[model samples]
Target: MDVQSGLPRCSRHPDVETGIRCTRCEQPVCPSCMIPASVGFQCPDCVRGGSGTGHAPGANQPRTLVGGRLRTDGRAVTKVLMAVNLALFLAVHTAGDRLVDRLDLIGHAYYPVLGEVVGVAEGEWYRLFTSMFLHQDLVHFLFNMMGLWVIGGIVEPELGRGRFAALSLLSGLSGSALVYLLAPPNQPSLGASGMVYGLLGAWAVLARYRRSDMRPVVVFLGLNLLITFTRPDISWEAHVGGLVAGVLLTAAMVYAPRARRELVQYGACALVLLSVLGMVLVRTAVLL
Candidate 1:
């Protein structure tokens, strides 16, 4: 029993004399105690009763969130957003054409008093957000909202509520800002097309980031971009602005290292918003 200062054999297999340590419990073990895993090996005892028995046990197993009806992640920001859009749609109808005239974005509104009240005139900016919720006609409204529901379903879970809301609002503002700068003044425009296009841009980029199949996204963007160029009476300028905002904002969110992810992402968002305002101010100075 004393071959090279033979110690007592394994606790479980005394006849087998070998020296190997359990990765988890760190007890002396023979070859028999080793359990193979994807990365290195575990001890028989550790494998039998999960990985961590010392601290908070089975902490990772349970689902933390039960997303929306479609998404089981325990979060329903997308659903809430859709509901809000629908409510606004109803409100727009209830308010009648007068509301559209007031809410729809334009480079300039003739009614300075109304514009001032709603932030649509000089130094007024509420139209940037309000316009995104308005629609010139029923068909236009449905088309844009359909795009929102489809894309929001895909993108929301990935970004979560806070970031999703930020993206939509900023993208919508950027769209209206561009329209204000480029489109003819006093010509009103409405609908969420700009925001929808922005979502498409961001979705395509994010899909590429995950190394997923990007053919469908690419095709969808191509078709929509084509339509934007061909369509008459459409503010194509807004589409361009929203697309640029979405792509850049998403890039900031996706590429940030894990060490300071939230800090960098939200910071980027704030900077983008400030840049939009800066652009608007410069445009206002030039026009007025």
Candidate 2:
């Protein structure tokens, strides 16, 4: 505020005095910098980052996946997810030989915490999530962790922690649903393969939407899916389910309108979960 002029000088244009403050940032602005918005006047900086802005400028964008991840800060969430996978793998081995079977998706096992052990025949439900964390062997654990290390490192920074976590978990659950629907009732399925595929799907969708070269990602995913089907012991159902979940969830995250991104993403996540739940209900009814 200028004592003599009876006006406030703009923060950016200090020489100019203004009678109004910006509605958004509430900073004094000269009329030139004051941009008219839906509610009120906003500064140029806010307008650039807000809904007024359209597609990101591709001229300055990176052309490589490595560039995309490294462009942001360190991927702490990726490291955390990897560490958790390692810890769960170790814990599964230490606990007991049968623990993996119990943790793996059974579509029928339900053991109450600190209570009696529940069997698939008893309608156990925790396996859907626990199975995602549990691994059958060191080889299985290493391969999945490798996928997480690579994919999570790439996706987490772009989507942030919450969105990535949601994608991973939903992908896992969708995999479980597929296994439940396709595999024999007594068969147990376990691994983070579904979530890994989900990350792949997410990366692919994001790259395609952003107009980046998606060939590398697509080829990698295709090769893995090939192996998934040819391998006798592999659960192809989990892979397909996870890939679909990842693509759908990531689409929701990336394609959401700028004005309602988080809201739309969370809603999409809920819709995915509900669809998974519906699958489980249909399977359970058939099993009963």
Each model's backbone clash number = 8, 5
> What TM-score does candidate 2 get on C-alpha atoms?
0.72
Over 1-288, each residue of candidate 2 has an lDDT whose tens digit, in order, gives: 635677878777888999875544456678998888644576676566533332234322222221222234446766777787788888877887567656777755433542464533356778888888878688988999999988887787677666777888899889888888778776778888888999999989888887988889989988998899888999898899999999998887777764576688889999999988888888888877
Clashing pairs in 1: 65-73, 65-74, 66-73, 66-74, 67-72, 67-73, 67-74, 67-75
Off by over 4 Å in 2: 1-73, 109-121
Give per-residue lDDT, candidate 2, residue 125. Answer: 72
lDDT of 1 by residue, 138-244 (tens): 78877887888889877776676667777787888888888887787777888788788778878987898889999999899999889899989888988888888
Highest lDDT, which number?
Answer: 2
Q: Model 1, which residues run further than 4 Å from truth?
A: 1-75, 111-119
State the C-alpha lDDT per candidate: 0.71, 0.75
